[model samples]
Target chain A: MSRVGVVAIRRGIRVSIYLPIAELSVNMIILLAMGGAVGFLSGMFGVGGGFLITPLLIFYNIPPAVAVATGANQVIASSFSGALAHFKRGTVDIKLGMVLLAGGVAGSSVGVYVFALLRALGQLDLIVSLLYVVFLGTIGALMMWESIGALRKAGKGGSTTLKKPGQHNWVHRLPLKVRFRASKLFVSVIPVLGLGAFIGFLASIMGVGGGFIMVPAMIYLLKVPTNVVIGTSLFQIVFVAAFTTIVHASTNQTVDVVLAFLLMLGGVAGAQYGAKVGQRLRGEQLRALLAGLVLIVAIRLAVDLFVRPADVYSLAPGVL
Target chain B: MKRCARKHALAVIGMLLAVAVGGPSAFAQDQGEPPRETINIGLSTEVVAITPDFSGADLTIFGSLENPDPQILRQGRYDIIVVLEGPLRPVVVRRKDRIFGLWINVDSETFSSVPVSYSVAMTRAPQDITDAKSYKQLSLGIDNIHLRPAGENADPSKTEEFGLALRSLKQRSGLYNERVGSLTFIGSNLFRASLALPANVPVGTHRARAFLFRNGSFIDEASDQLMIVKSGTEASIYRAANTYGFFYGVFAVILAVITGWIGRIVFKRD
Candidate 1:
């Protein structure tokens, strides 16, 4: 029998394919569906969808190591697709992305080393879970509050104040300034690089693309244009996630190529449809919806941590 | 599911019948006035092929007791325990403790030569069939499996606790299984046991050992080797990832980039 042929047992139940790296058999249909859903949300919200996909994979009982590594692999496809769209529209700030990527590369190396230490101590899962709770909770709540205010102002016929491109903030006061033409801003490179590196580190640890954190940071802290922020962050994310994948592959050997392929197959197609659907929604409503989703995911993670677990003792393969 | 199970049952029966017909003369050689205890065992599948669609599999072990007196058999003079053990590897078991309102892994133990998967089916419980000492010596039950600490001078009691925790975790994941009264007697002197291999069963040369106990005493044993291997695309991918991991990672990234670029071009409207 051909290896790839559908395995139908006597009971008419189609057997699932095994993922070598994950060491589990998963239904292809389920993975495809998950990838499609996450990709659609990613395209619509201008987020990498890593925040959602990582937790979801864990929920399905995938090993956290495999999930995190493969999650980075899946993010690359969607981020690349989104970045391309932004590039065509001339919204991507290549200089800003390059600056961010430089820091991200260094940060990811450190993150991978730290991840190995945590895994040795058997604390990687706890740390990853806590990270999701803290970052997702804070970011989600803040975004919800901001979007709600925006919606209220729009409802009351009050125009929201937009920050001027050349407005001098404490960030601009720092030395090592650089001009990003697409963003229409002259900002100190220190904070920008530092922000990118910090997010990259978290992304490596948490198995996320870090676009959720990068988007808001650029908008509020760096004062970059909203149109350019998404594209630039995505551009940086492609490199960060790609670098993370290679690091994980060579170091941990945790990347499941089959699982990543199944997810990316659905993700690429779903992203296209999601972008089309996104055009119908207003900016404030989309932000509000995205905030709600982020909050929901955060709450679920909190529940996992706080609630009593069914099994308190866990067994993991020996760390090298 | 029922049909599949039935099919598997029929296949196992057919194989056993073939073996029984071919081996009767060997059994007759041992026949005597005082029927001696003997076991003839064969596995339905000598080699398990793990194709890409290998979710899991069921292997049937069938055997016959040669020259068993009817009265002795009626009095339950024989007990059989069949154990299927996968390849061994090192494993770490962690225990979570509530510390300052949060559950954290505070203690961990590492052990070498731990079976990745194990399943035992017996005619009766180990306690009922044999003494505790023999059970431990033979590794007849999950608790009795030997898991030595990996190069550490650890406390025996602490290691025992960790071993229990490891066994519990593996059992929950369906990696370690123990089933009593699962070895069914098809007819007089003919017995069969079915082992269900989980999807996560490690790939290696595994051994299935069947032990026959008579009146709470170890009598005879039979062992057979079963090779579990990854075949086709699964094998290729696994081989490449391990041998050429760097190139594999690069290929993965490039594949994603190309797919993403193509997705935009094909789907873009206006």
Candidate 2:
């Protein structure tokens, strides 16, 4: 019997595995390696790796829907493990995290609804790519700018201390103030909830844990202590990502457990080593490197949008 | 229609049997009014179970032509076409147009009840066996398969464009395919056809249809059902995902949590 179809048989041994929900066979080692690479980056940056994983999966030709949903699923594992470490260190602000979780849940619900709407409208891929380009470009550019300034200061033998948190911003003047004992600050619930909701929305749509956005927002916007920021952001991300995964699975039925599992296994293992390596690097240098990586991804996605596709037409499973 | 075809096939088989037992004189006497030719196909297995590592396989369909004309068979005037058509489902075809330096989906058309996959094997080139008119009438070839736009009043030109796009996309993906000269005569009466089942073949009930053409004219046609399904664990996973999505979602989350916990324990350094 002659074998035929998309997967061409190579001369050497190849370990291919089938993803049930994705409905395709992919090289197992390639998936694991992708997970490990993203996991390493996330560990070094003290962020969830969902932002990297979703786009990588898309590049590998996994359907955007499956890639997004499964990315959310994979984020839960890394964030949960990271959160556990933070919990042990007693750095996570549980009260602040809970409030953020509340807003995240609500925002995720709306995001999932919109995701389905966009998918049905046959604009999901475009919207997803567009969003990635916008967010990644903005964040990467900002990080690069900030870190370069810090690097220049250090080069001149000046202390690269972070800005004093007590300096009040307009966000501090907002109403509905809430006190979080762990972070030792008084902050408005309005911005906290809104920020959580915004990240949650992006998490559901982009299949990210939102840590890349959440950590910075906590430190710069909410004025949360830097010591507690990573832990608290991760705490909320764990639950938010969990919530997004369940909803996407139940509503869209797009989550592939097999794919998620492979990613998670490789991720958690790689993260530990990444964290060790991260500790040896200076904060400014790490930020600069991460910014460069993010910008490259953004530029690649932008190129795809601008370049003519191989085919002008595409097919979807359902009627529009 | 299937029952009628089956009856015709039985009659052809009965006549062939009578001629076999009644000797040369019996066949000579029956030649004055030649019996109608009929086609029948049998699959080696009723269902094809795809394992996890399944790449692709050739599905051999054994068939026979009853009451075939001796002269037509000898002269290679008889031709057979076998098609394995996947289950029907609605499909949307979208066209991307350049908008502000970005290619975005600007137009789309929906086609209902479109076959998910169509694989055809023939005794000869489709054009060599029959005229285009006959092929279109019978809907025997890929181009001949009718695609109906979901909207009743869709633009004819747009609908045709989308329909062509859909066919080419399916062909590019190996879901819709054709293999010329894949059917061969085993002897004088029996023929075998090999249809390539692509690795990405959709799991559902597929129809195996055989069309007979003698001297470039349409003759009898017959079809049988074949089930293509994922086997064991893969089958259960697919079913569970579609059927009990809520529980599956919960399970997925729990599995992730456990994996995370275990990873920390095994590789714990802190």
Local distance difference test scores for all models: 0.82, 0.88
TM-score attained by model 2:
0.94
Docking class of 2: medium
Per-residue error for B243 in candidate 2, Å, reads 1.1
lDDT of 1 by residue, B1-270 (tens): 663354344443333443554355433442222324577788777777877665567668998876553444677868899999999888988888887677888988889889999989999877899999998888778888999988559889889899998988888767899888889888777899978786567789898989988778887888988898888877788878888888888888898888778777777654
- Candidate 1: tens digits of C-alpha lDDT, residues A1-320: 21123334312556366787886667788889889998888778777899999998988778888889889988998899888778888889999999999999888989988988898899988898889989989988887887889889999998755434555568878999899898898988999889989977987898899988898789878999888998899999999999999988888777888889888888887877777788888777888898899889888987887777777788877853
| TM-scores of the candidates, chain A only | 0.92, 0.96
- The recovered share of true contacts, given per candidate in order, is 0.67, 0.80
What DockQ do the predictions score, one after another? Answer: 0.44, 0.70
> Is model 1 an incorrect, acceptable, medium or high docking prediction?
acceptable
Each candidate structure's count of clashing pairs: 1, 0
Estimated TM-score for each candidate: 0.86, 0.94
Model 1 chain A: which ten-residue window has the lowest total lDDT?
A: A2-11
